[model samples]
Target: MQIVDHGRVSVGCHVANGWTVVEATGEMDIFTSPMIRAAIIKLLQDGHRHFVLDLCPTAFLDSMGLGMIVAITKRIQAHQGSLRIACADQRLLHIFSLGGLRKSYAFHDSVDEATREVPRHNGLGRWPRPRD
Candidate 1:
């Protein structure tokens, strides 16, 4: 796991053999959302469509952050990829659920579980199987 600091925000990236887990901390409003967006996009460009974003440490999130998530989800879907979030905070979970995004993205409790759910690199050529 490697942590990259972008001033107010910190992005912790855990790269496994096939998956990449990003743990974001600090505020994710209009100002810092782009950094998160870019980081995810870069991974996508690197042919990593399966992702797990751990937002447990995130203090706050605004519309822009939510929008970025939506956009990333769409991008992943477009490529027949998958994206999940590990967020245990009730407030953030409430916002995601109330916003109707709960049905769109899978939420997990830990990075280990998230990565386990994601398929291996060889399986990326095909769309993900439905979760049980």
Candidate 2:
């Protein structure tokens, strides 16, 4: 996936198996909130409720970005889906923890772990059969 720029923020998306991975870079303040929101919403609309937000490359994150994530989580939960966040940045991690988001969202140390752990659902309401 190529990096998509919305002003100073860069967002990239890719799909592996049934997980939709979104890698975000640059500042994530109010100015870049719309881009992030749009990317997430688009994925959900495309029938991709399982998400792995790779934020290791993200340089900054503000309240707007945090709110967007929380909103996405709510939407995913409504659909019986899940959202995992991969963030190795200390600053970002601290912010999430301090904001109480860590308790609400699943945080992973790596993108691989996030993607591997997200549950895959079969439209029939049961989890997809595990792979061998």
Candidate 3:
């Protein structure tokens, strides 16, 4: 179901199998990160752990946007939860690599694959993340 709709981005949540898929469409920058951040935090507070971030429709992700994602990931890790990102956009994938975050997080080709009961992950979790 759709959760929040802001000018720059829209956040939606759906149950796929046993996991929750949180889809974000449109640009996610400084202007929209706060809203997304709040929504994710609320989900966390509500005991939603594992997440599938369907960023297929997300067109842009600035520094603030990337930072928000990293922050949320840290929080999820703190809770022993996992996050899978589904971003087919080549630009975003390239940005993830350029930002030195490719190994820090897991990326899937589609949301369907990402929202599986178990998210794929490597044993090592020592990658550097964006600073707060």
Candidate 4:
């Protein structure tokens, strides 16, 4: 994993089970969210269609960070790809719920669990085997 430490935030990535797992650590706020976004965008440019964003190690997530995530998800879906979030922090989960994003993403307890259920999306933008 090539991890890039951008001050208070660091991002690393690796491929597992045909999905690119992007692990983000440290605070994700207005100043640090861009680093995370850039990393994911670079992967997308490199033809990575499936992704698992592992945010378990993240200590903080502000509105900017949440917006960045939503934007990334939209971009992935536009490419007929998918993005799943692996986050176990209850506080973060609650934030997601409060932001009305619980239905917008597949949140997992771990990266293993998230990668195990990669959605098999067809060219028509439909998942033949819906992931749990």
Candidate 5:
């Protein structure tokens, strides 16, 4: 795993069980959103289909940060990719829930668990899944 520490956040990435786990640490607000977005975009361009965003250490997440996640989700879906999110902070989880995003993607308890469940790719956004 290669870890790069930036001014406001430290980003780390590694491949685990065929899934790319990107660990982001620190406040994820307007100031630091671009850095994270660039990293994810690069990963996607590099042909990584499955992704896990480990936001366990995110101290704060503003609208820009949420936008980044939303944009990435769209990009991944367009490429027929999948996404998993691992966030430890209950407060931050509540923010996602409030935005009606809690059920849009799979939320895992840990990054390790997310990597193991990379094959589970539910449809993106609020689109209804076809009844089986």
Candidate 6:
């Protein structure tokens, strides 16, 4: 497992059941969102296609953090990958709802629940078009 700590926040990642689980501890704000983004980007570069973002331990989140997740989601989708978010915190859940992102992501109550099923894809791998 690799972890990056920056005083206010700490990020860690590990592979589980064919999925990469990235967990964040502490507040995810302007000061710490980068660590989460960097970790996921590195994992994607490392050939990971499926991911479970375990934000259960996160105590706080800000607009920048939400934006970072949105950007990361787009990047992962563009790469033909999948991302599931595990968050059981009511406050955070309310924030997501208020941000109008509740329907945009697949959210679960726990990491185990999130990793139990494979995300549905369009039957295309990394490349959408076939070679001629």
Top candidate (TM-score): 4
Q: For candidate 3, lDDT tens digit of each residue in 1-132?
A: 788897878999977765668889998898999899899889889987778889998989988888898888887777666677898888998888887887667688998777655543421244355323
Higher-ranked by lDDT: 4 or 5: 4
Instruction: Provide the overall lDDT of each model, using Cα atoms, as 2-decimal numbers.
Output: 0.74, 0.75, 0.79, 0.83, 0.79, 0.81
Weakest lDDT window of 10 consecutive positions for candidate 5: 123-132
Clashing pairs in 3: 1-13
Can you write out model 1's per-residue Cα lDDT over 91-128, one digit (the tens) per residue? 99887767766655678887777777546443323323
Stretches off by above 4 angstroms in model 3 are: 117-132
Q: What is candidate 5's lDDT per residue for 1-132, written digit by digit as tens?
A: 645578788888988987888988898888888888888888889888778889887888877888889888888777777778898789988888787676666788898878774454534533323223
User: Once all C-alphas are superposed, what RMSD does model 3 give against the true structure?
Assistant: 3.8
Pairs that collide in candidate 5 are none
Per residue, candidate 4 scores C-alpha lDDT tens digits across 12-81 of 9999998899999999999988888888888889898888999999999888999899888777877788
Models 1 onward score TM values of 0.81, 0.83, 0.87, 0.89, 0.86, 0.88
**RMSD, candidate 2, Å:** 5.6
lDDT of each residue in 8-94, candidate 6, tens digit only: 888888887777899999999998888889888888888887888899999999889999998887778777887888999999988
Our model 6 lands, by Cα RMSD against the true structure, at 5.6
Native-vs-model 6 lDDT? 0.81
Question: Comparing 1 and 4 by TM-score, which wins?
Answer: 4
How many residue pairs clash in all the candidates, one count each? 0, 0, 1, 0, 0, 0
